[model samples]
Target chain A: MLSIQNLHVQVEEKEILKGINLEVKPGELHVIMGRNGTGKSTLANVLAGRDKYTVPQGNITFNNESLLDKTPEDRACSGLFLSFQYPVAIPGVNNMYFLKAAVNAIRKSRGQDEMDAIDFLAMVREKLKEVALDESFIHRPVNDGFSGGEKKRNEILQMITLEPQLSILDETDSGLDIDALKIVAQGVNDYRSPERSFILITHYQRILNYMQPDFVHVLMNGKLVKSGTMELANELEEKGYSWIEKELTAAD
Target chain B: MENEIIKKSIAEEYKYGFETKVAQDTFPPGLDEGVIRALSDIKGEPEWLLEWRLKAYHHWLNMKEPTWAKVHYPPIDYQSISYYSAPKKKTLNSLDEVDPEILDTYNKLGIPLDEQKMLAGVAVDAVFDSVSVATTFKDTLKKAGVIFCSFSEAVKDHPELVQKYLGSVVPYTDNFYATLNSAVFSDGSFVYIPKGVRCPMELSTYFRINAANTGQFERTLIVADEGSHVSYLEGCTAPMRDENQLHAAVVELVALGNAEIKYSTVQNWYPGDKEGKGGIYNFVTKRGACRGDKSKISWTQVETGSAITWKYPSCILQGNDSVGEFYSVALTNNFQQADTGTKMIHLGKNTKSTIISKGISAGKGQQTYRGEVKIMKSAENSRNFSQCDSILIGDECGAHTFPYIDVRNSTAQMEHEATTSNIGEDQLFYCNQRGISTEDAVSLIVNGFCKEVFKELPMEFAVEAQKLMEVSLEGAVG
Candidate 1:
């Protein structure tokens, strides 16, 4: 349901992503393992249509529709969700208000009727259970003053609320304790459906214990250098990224 | 795309920009002894009251315009401004006698001048230009022994109370603007809550400036008698104009023994144009005096307009064990400028005060929060706390804080905290990536920033304040 081809992205006159290619089919969870500065986060941001990240050459398509031309909000309305690694604190906007605006915006784009406050609250309360959030959490400002784990769980709650067609988790596993990782992973597993797809961008394979992925890819030096099955994640966990670096050097 | 959005936002016009067509009889231009005497005569003031105006006029002449505020504006020509303009229609003894055209003005302003149709709990006194056109729900107020009417009407009907308390809190010569307002002030509302009687409803005054080239100087006074309580609301809005108009107002409050007064304001005067062509230069003085033991006074304001706003609503806690509170949310967008805050003067023993102020600046707007807390030698054991926060939406805008504290008594306690934050690009990107537009994101951030002060406003005004904030930042971010 998501495709990226020849993705060359730069930030601040420095190339961060060099000719990367990725593809994910419906109901598939593709884990992209990479070290810091390897452009995995840049790929997620570019896919979510963030500015200041220049895509010099490449094309991304979601559900067979071009995503390169859409604004960040438009891309989100098109069912592309990116769970930020660091959820920015929006001090005044309540989490519930933010979600309602997002939900209505997406619904408007999709020509669906807006949800009433009662229904919205009911739905949000139901989803909060999956992420272990309480009722008060929705009324608080978006991620303001939240702990790292709470932010990740809040992001997961948003994912559950929005129910996007293509979800990209940008190192959401970081800063999360083991318990939080499991809850977050449980949220993702609960949200999974045959019509939805996921791009799990992470550095470690610890979270893989909670939710299994269909494929694994290693990103290094701004490109995907290796592809394999779940066994690759175990191998990388045991051998470390140095093995992939040695293999790349040998191939070069 | 960014520039296109900026241009569109810069072109954003005032929503309350429409002028009402009415036949107006304006006083001759220029401020002099004759002008003050004529205004006094029009109100049929007592000889002593007229003498007070003359004294204020002389004091105003000697006082120079205060340029110390963190705002920039051209020198005001006092003589070029016409002091008064009133609807030519005869004074209405009742709602039926009120001219339909005049009622139409307030109607378009979302304020139904018809008393019976007004919000059940609010008694609105509609002030149009130089006159108080209508004061609604008088019968209900009268039943509660509350005297609510125009300042001019009070001069004729309740002369004793008006004379006893006029300028008692904020003297005529208190400051430059207060002196000018005292000299030729038009009509504003006067409210009196009798001893031991809580006001039956929220007393509100809606001030509108309709006449051109005429300055609107309204005087409001509210006295809460012993053991009484009252909440007062004042809202101001002006039509869009190319030539800058002037608004200098004086508001005074006196709370007697065990009494409490809560005064709120939502000032939305036209903030000129994007290039700062035309708007109101708002210079206002508002103060409350806790005159008796255990008295209390609180002021909450939402200011989001005016080309230049220079106002400080202060409280003088003069009674033993008195309390004072100030909560404000001041926003400036486009070419608007505002330097607004509060002053808490502790004069009585064991008095206490709290101040919370929020300032938001967007586009080319400049905002400043100037506050003061003073503890006198007599006010031993007095306590005070002040918090000032500012949020800037764009880099081109500015936010500033100036806080002054003076304590003569070693036993007094005072605390101050200030913080500055910006609606960063990352924050907006985060919201946008989640399906919210930039405009909605700005509003959310700003509303969150002002949530503390907004909770202090009355429910209806709080909703309107949020909407006003959103409207002010229409073109602020892209």
Candidate 2:
């Protein structure tokens, strides 16, 4: 569903993602684990068309279309979604209103009729139950005064409602408690279909126990040095990332 | 490139700038006691009212125009402006007698005057430039012991009430511009709700500046007697002109014991072109006095236009336990400058006041909120809460807050909070990533920021204010 080849991304004149390559087939879940400052977020932002990052050398193809020329909105309309680590608090825009605008905008781009308020609200309430978010959240400001857990759960509600072809969950499990992690994992498991793909970027392996990834890749110093299955995640969780760093240094 | 996008976004054309073609009855360009007497004679005002106008004219002659506001504009030449200009038309005894051309103009402006005249009981007093053209629901209002008519009609028919309440709240000598307005004021609305009676319907007045180069100085007065209640709304619009038109108006509200008066204004005067060539210099003085114990007054205004706007609709809480509120949303875009706020004067025991102001400046527009809250020594246990917030869309605009608070009574409690911030890049990106356009995103964020003040507007005015904000800030960001 997504392909990245020799992606060299720079922010503030310094390349963060150096010569990185990855690919994920439809319905596959890819987990990219890395330490701090090792380009896990850089890869996610570059894929979602954030304007601050400049790509000098690389090409990204999503669903057989090049993403380099697309705007953030265009990329969003094309079923590419990025769940930010920290969502901004848009205080005056109601959560439900923002969701309707987003949903209608994407629908319009795909030649679909706009959803009326009554039908949209009914659908949104059902999705909110999947993520354990209260129905009252529809009236509140978007993430304004929300706890970290509530913000993540709202993100899951959005993902469930939009039903995007590909979703990049950036540190989705970092702020969740044990029960919230299980609920969030349940939401993802429920939404999974043969046509949907997910790229889970995280620093901790604790959430991996709840949701299984088809492929686990260890990212070190802007490059993926290891790729394997579920057992490799257990191996790294037992040993930590230092062993992988030392092995990379020995190989160099 | 970034600057270009911001500039393109704020270059929205003024859609209501079309001129209305009508033969004008304009006075010669000048200002003096003679001109004031001529104005009084034209309106057939009483002798005592003529003397009152002369007194205000003498006072205005000695006072200098204030330049202390945080706005810069070219000096206004009072001698060059014609103080009175009205469309030449015969007296209309009924709606059917009204001119078709004038009716079409209001219809095109989307004013509900025609629709209300056709249907139910919304009393409307339509003021065009220097005259009160048509007042609807006249007999219905009279049956309820409510005197709703033009200022001229009130002066002729109900001279005692007009003489009693005119300038009672904001006296003629109150300020520089108000003094001039009192002297040469042509026509506006006059509403009086009698004791123990609630007005049956909302009272509305629409002011339109259809004449070019003619200054608009209208006076509005409303008196709510003991145990009475009324909700009054005022709205204004002007045609586009090359020369700046001056508008100095005074509004006074009097609420007696246990009476409540709610006054709302949606002001959309012509705010000059992209470079701010020509628009109205809107200097208005509006104040309501809570005279009797337990009286309440609320002023809600949405100021969205004018090249330079200087207004402060205030409330004087002189009655024990009286309450006052000022809710305003002032938005300026593309070279407009506005310095507006409100005043709360607490003079009685246990009086309270609340002020919520939201100022939005986009493009090169500059907005300032200047508010004052005063608690006298006798105003024991009075409380005041003031919140002022500002949002700047582009880089060049400015927002300033000046809150002057004085509390002589130690028992009085006062709270003030102010905030100023730019549109965050992250907020825009977040919206953009959700497939929303940048312009729509800006509007969403700004509307959220102004939700507090918008809630105070009447239903239709709230929708108009929101759309006005969107038009003012459209394409102001990349």
Model 1 clash pairs?
Answer: A92-B448
**What's the CA error at residue A41 for candidate 1, in Å?**
0.7
Q: How far is candidate 2 from the true structure (C-alpha RMSD, Å)?
A: 1.5
Go through the candidates in order and give each one's C-alpha lDDT: 0.90, 0.89
Give the TM-score comparing model 1 with the true structure, all chains together.
0.98
Model 2 chain A weakest lDDT span, ten residues long: A42-51
lDDT of 1 by residue, B1-478 (tens): 3434455565466888888888898997899999888889877889988999999999988999897999887788889999999988877588787778878888888885787677657999989998998888899999999999999999889999999999999999899999999899988989999999989888999999988999999999999999999999888899999999999999999999999999999999998998888999999999999999999999999998899999999999999999999999998888889999999999999999999999988778899899999999999899999999998876778999999999999999888999998778888888898888898888888888899999988898899899988888887887
Model 2 stretches astray by more than 4 angstroms:
B1-4, B115-121
Number of backbone-clashing residue pairs for each candidate, in the order shown:
1, 2
Model 1, A61: alpha-carbon shift in Å? 0.7
Report the CAPRI category for model 2. Answer: medium
> Per-prediction TM-score, please?
0.98, 0.98
Against the native complex, each candidate's DockQ, computed on alpha carbons, is: 0.77, 0.75
Candidate 1 achieves a global lDDT of 0.90
Which lDDT tens digits does candidate 2 get at residues A56-138?
99999999999989988999999988888898889888999999999998999999999999999999989988988888998
Question: What is the overall TM-score of model 2 with all chains considered together?
Answer: 0.98
Model 1 segments beyond 4 Å from truth? B1-8
